[model samples]
Target: MVQHSYAVGMFPATLISLKVKPMNNQEHDEAVLHRLLFQINMEIADQTPKERELFSNSSSHFIGPPQRIAEDNIRLGLMIVLFLAGTPLNVTAMMRLRRSMLSSATPLKQLKQHLNISDLMILLIYTSSQIVWLITVDWRSNDLMCKLLKFSHALCFSVSSNVIVCIAIHRFSMVFGKSTKRVTTVSLWVAWTLAVATSLPQFAVWTVYRPYETATWQQCVSIWFVREYDIRTKNKTLLAEPLISSTAYSVYHVLIVFWIPAALLIICYLRLAMVVSKEIYCECECVKQSQSTPLTNGNMPSTDQHVTSSRRLLSRIISFSSSSSGRFEKALMRHQCVTMRRKRNAIRTCLLLIVAYIFCWLPYNAFFLWGLIDHDSYQQWHNTSIAFLRYLIVVNSVTNPFIYLPNFRSALCSSHAVQS
Candidate 1:
């Protein structure tokens, strides 16, 4: 793999060299490679059939494996499990939350107005693409299905990334109390429109018919990525000829999901934390003052008395906040401001989701980058390692949704109980 990586055509060198910045990450990459190799070696007890052929009959001058197909099945099966487990929870939660917000007749009625129907549609389409691609037949062997699959794949992948970016930006605006209306409107339209636009190149560049040896059938692929080297390379990236939009899609993901958006997430969260912390502190101080002041007696108040006094003060303050009376009006304005900030706490949550995506998918992206570069290194035995790594990475996606379930247990329980 290293040897082929040094040579011209494989995906790694292009990926590696394409970067403008010299990586401080090489050591990490090397360590990761070692771990992957060790895992692969442990999994495969024999010389792989694919490696054996590539070293022997293959003109590509590769080593090991007659086929990595079985290894792929194992890896993909695990991914499918993790992915399926995740979808129901994360998507359902988002869907339900949005629905709840929209249906509410409560004070947070603003939430309904902000829930863009287009963005919701985009999210659903993206989720659908994931599930659809998982269940569909291997389209690589057939012309029509190949194009359709590739197109939908690109649509799902790109739109999801874009939507995430939009969501993050929207939340950022909300958190800072900026012009959320503009951000929301822009992001909503861009998310769906670009989603449709991104799918076009996938259809355009796809040949629809793939070259397969007599031994090959319409079985699912060993590589989930046979991405093109350049969008215009007109050749295979690793093992597959992806659409012309492939390079663009990869670049967008790397930037939005990994680099640019990640930095923005950190910044937004820092700002949000500062804002929320200040608000909490102010409220805490006011409440403390109210609690500390005795009835001119400085005597300790009974617990119930303290609670009643606090509730009464809170109610009076809340009511005063709606008033236009001179001195009380200023207090009212402050209260309204704080109340608005609380509603915007949802923005902080959006940034956190960005953080979550970074943590969850970073390994998978790194693996893809490294493996594609080292495709030559990916002998029959190497496939086992790649498979194992892929399984672990995909597991993140599944675990993400379930991991948060515990946090929302009360809500889930209430929803279930209500239904029951």
Candidate 2:
């Protein structure tokens, strides 16, 4: 009896035995052994189709189908557009902001400039990764690189979202607290630190995973734990589970990225609007009272002169009430006017940003949540919807400059004129 062993791809080695009749010739024994090996090869070849069928069936249940090539081409084209458009827009916005800051380095202007910087970082990180994905089939070949890319994408997104929140908070403080300066250097540093800390978990949760154990391509996917499944042949297979639970992570992401910021923005802007309306109403009343005041000469004053005389009379009344009170009232009114104007401008800029954020991010987050809740149904349109949503998110970065740059430039020019 002669025994031979052979190993096939991803399969255990097996031994086959060949029995030969008694032969005195060594050459004949060798030839018989060769014939038996050839027969074994033919049998193995005949079994290849069944093995492939099993693999295909098992893999289909987990890995799903590849994305349609037409959809992929469209997605790639859109990503290229984002890269071309967002890059230049962000760079231009950053430069314009820097130039303005050089001329007038106020706390508010600095905060706005910092926001531009955050958006720029987000555009760079996300667009670069997206471009790589579009260009390469197996971009996640290296585990370390995969983890780093996923971490960076999350970090940039969190930082940008938090920065928008910071802007809202800063405007709220300035409007309600009657403060000129908001968002100090310390506060900005703290905001960024928190953002970075919030995003750190991504590095731990994401890693390179092989959807098919023997497949050449690897995916960068979120992995919580190892799960084992028994297939038809009693073969056990392992799959990666999500670390934070898909539902939990989806809820957390939506809350942090969308709901909280949207709520804060709405509340702050509404309160600020009411405050401005009240101030304008009071100013109008003061003007009417001034206009109604009779002149000693009994000659009606022109509109400009009437306004000036009314202000003077009010000042006298305020001074007569108490000199310190009069001075305080004048200073307060001046501060209120300046702060209110700045607040209105800030609100306008922030409203555009918040609206853009919602428009771009909400659908994507909603889809993600839906996928988590009912993955089977969601998988039907997963490739198409996700690709579109991702492009929409990138569009936000591209649109920000167009939406806010004009306002920023006009504000900058107005400030220069006032300074002159």
Candidate 3:
């Protein structure tokens, strides 16, 4: 006899029995156990460990598709174009600025010379790093090369930004403050120091690492506070971790690079505009007063000699007042006009450069910030927009020389001519 019992929830148990000829007890139990084990094995074999983990953890990141070959070619092509065009322009700018400095030691001339040097250094470092990446097909084989490229990129970018800020500040001081020459010289040194200090962390934050031991592809990526996972497979994964959290870094970059400099520039230019306008108004008023003033002579003579002498006396009085105030006013107006013209030219040059920088970098920073806040959405946007944004950022360096130097070419040439 065999008996089996089953119980349903919230109900009494029921027992059922079947009568049969006696069999081996051990064999009967062994056969039932084997059937249960087989069913469990079949269920377990249906799912892989990775699949099970994916199902369990809904928050895991999804990798995006790799960049297409055509995209890579297009990017490399654009970089080459930038190198060809920007390199010569930057070199020319540096040479012209050097020659100008040799002829004059004025504060304004010194500022231009420093600006050219900064731009030249930036162009050389940025272009060289990019060319290396293009030649090596993204530095797949050389770990040291990757690190050097990443470091140079960061350092040059920071230096460029800080140099622009210093330029703006110098212009602002020249218009609004006393002792501008000394202040500008001090600021230039400080700017270079700050740039180097800020960019030094790139060395610690970035490195070339093979995420998968079996894969041939190696990535230049940030490894600070990073957690790496190695999954052996044919598909390659691209993952980067930064020393600071993405949110923090994004905020810091936007604040330091864009917002602060932009605010300073706007304030400086607005004040300069006011000063220029005031000078114009005062000059106009002075002219109106001078014209309205009537000539006075104490004695009127009938003789032609006396008349001529009287006219000459009136002219002398007008030119040289009792306090010489009229003569002083004329001198002041001439000085103001020259100063205003110089300030206007400086403002125009700086404004255009600032606009170019903002236009090129704004989109890239916007997308970078968006990526940090919503990664899944970022992945979708990145496929379409990242290429263009990256190109714009790199292209800014190329566009800068044209914007800065072309308008000033005549001036540079004239100075060179005068020196000769």
Question: Which predicted model would earn the best TM-score?
Answer: 3
Instruction: List, residue by residue over 1-420, the lDDT tens digit for candidate 1.
Output: 121211111111112111111135323232122211111110111122222232232222222323444543444465456546555655655665556666763322222222223223323443343334334323325656555654554454444455556666655576577787676667767765776675565454444222234344232221212232221123222322332234444445345334564565567667766776776667667645544552232232335455765877755654554342335535655785677566455644554556656665465456555544564444333333433442442343444433322256577668879999
Candidate 2 lDDT over 1-420, as tens digits, reads 222222111000001122223234323323432111111110111112122222233324354423324544665677678888778767877888788888988766677677777677766776666656655534346888766766676666666666666666676676566454634565677678876776666666556655557665554544431121122113322222321343355456556655676677677667766776686667656645544652332243334444765877755654455555446656666766675576567778777877888788777666655644564465457444555665676677777776666664476567679999
The C-alpha RMSD of each candidate to the native structure, in angstroms, is 12.5, 15.6, 17.6
Residue pairs in clash, model 2:
none
| Candidate with more favorable, higher lDDT: 1 or 3 | 3
Better of 1 and 3 by TM-score: 3
Better of 1 and 2 by lDDT: 2
Please identify which of the two predictions, 2 or 3, would achieve the higher TM-score against the true structure.
Answer: 3
- Quote each prediction's TM-score: 0.53, 0.65, 0.66
Alpha-carbon deviation at 66 in model 1, angstroms: 9.8
Question: What lDDT does model 2 reach?
Answer: 0.54
Worst 10 residues of 1 by lDDT: 35-44
| lDDT string, candidate 3, 1-420, tens digits | 222111100000001111122234323222211000000000011111112222121122332212224544565576678778777767777776677668876776566666666666655766555555545543255667645555555556666666677777777776666687798788778877766675555555555554334535444544421232231121112322321343244355455555666676677767766776686677667666664663233222325444775877665654555346646666766776676676667778878877887788677666655644554455445545655665575577767766666555576467779999
Ranking by TM-score: 3, 2, 1
Q: On a 0 to 1 TM-score scale, where does candidate 3 land against the true structure?
A: 0.66
As for lDDT, the candidate ahead, 2 or 3, is: 2
